[model samples]
Target: RSDRNNAIRSPTSIDMDHNDQDEVPTASLGTWIFLVVVAAVSFWSQATVTEERFVPALNVIANIFNIPDDIAGATLMAAGASSPELFSSFVALFITHSSLGLGT
Candidate 1:
């Protein structure tokens, strides 16, 4: 997901007309439609109202993120979804001087 562009000149083949125009091809129509559908599903399920739907949504996100093992990634994502709870747990442990909530 990184794009590297260098502006330095090379010592070789300088005599040629180095136009240096780059082409960036985009995703095809099918791919775009597929991704749009997937994104719509992901957002639709990121809510508690449709409680039974988020699992597939998270799985799709994991795949789009190039992660292996949908279940494991989904678990990690679920844990991350409750950021406030995590922060609260951390503060409570700190005030109580406990090593709790530190174990993965």
Candidate 2:
């Protein structure tokens, strides 16, 4: 048990964000609500930026490259949409030391 804990706490691992004391941390209801709100806003902002900026920029690139709209959407757009999954898989395998299986 101690060895497993030590492995989890190794320097290369992501910070667990806990105190040295062996006690569970607690959060108030207000704090939980605030965190939820912040998460929602963050997701909203990310989506807005991607839709407003990223996709249009890709479209411009496709035009500059003289790519057909269908081909561009099928290739570049599909790649753009799948990038988050690829990046998350990379993080899971490398940073989190987890396997990315079919479900992951």
Candidate 3:
């Protein structure tokens, strides 16, 4: 019926007006600059920590295990790089009850 057809709305029926687009919000310049500074500081700290602590710890571990420096470093770096993905998979499987992360 015409009444039912009028009542139903398709995805394309949503407003696409220029005035509405202009009213959409965005982050200010100051907020963007602050985020850049925070990111720079985060990268700097990570580099410093790796240089000062991680390398020395790796050397000690290599010495203890009688493993070559290159092998130990490579193994640890691979584990470190993959840890976020591994943990995300566990979280997706257990907490979120999804297998999406594992497939990724």
lDDT of 1: 0.67
Residue 73, model 1, lDDT: 58
lDDT of each: 0.67, 0.85, 0.84
RMSD of candidate 1 to the truth, in angstroms, is 16.9
Give the poorly placed runs of model 2, Cα more than 4 Å off: 1-22, 70-104
| Residue pairs in clash, model 2 | none
Give Cα distance to truth, residue 5, candidate 2, Å. Answer: 30
lDDT of 3 by residue, 1-104 (tens): 97777578564663432257677899999999999999999999999998999889878988999999889999977787788999988899889999776676
**TM-score preference between candidates 1 and 2, better one:** 2
Best by TM-score: 3
lDDT for position 2 in model 1? 23
- Score residue 31 of candidate 1 by CA lDDT: 100
Candidate with the larger TM-score of 1 and 3: 3
Residue-level lDDT of model 1, residues 3-103, one tens digit each, is 22233544464535465554456789999999999999888766653366655666677778776775655575667678777887787678776776566
Instruction: Please estimate how well model 2 matches the true structure, expressed as its whole-model Cα lDDT.
Output: 0.85
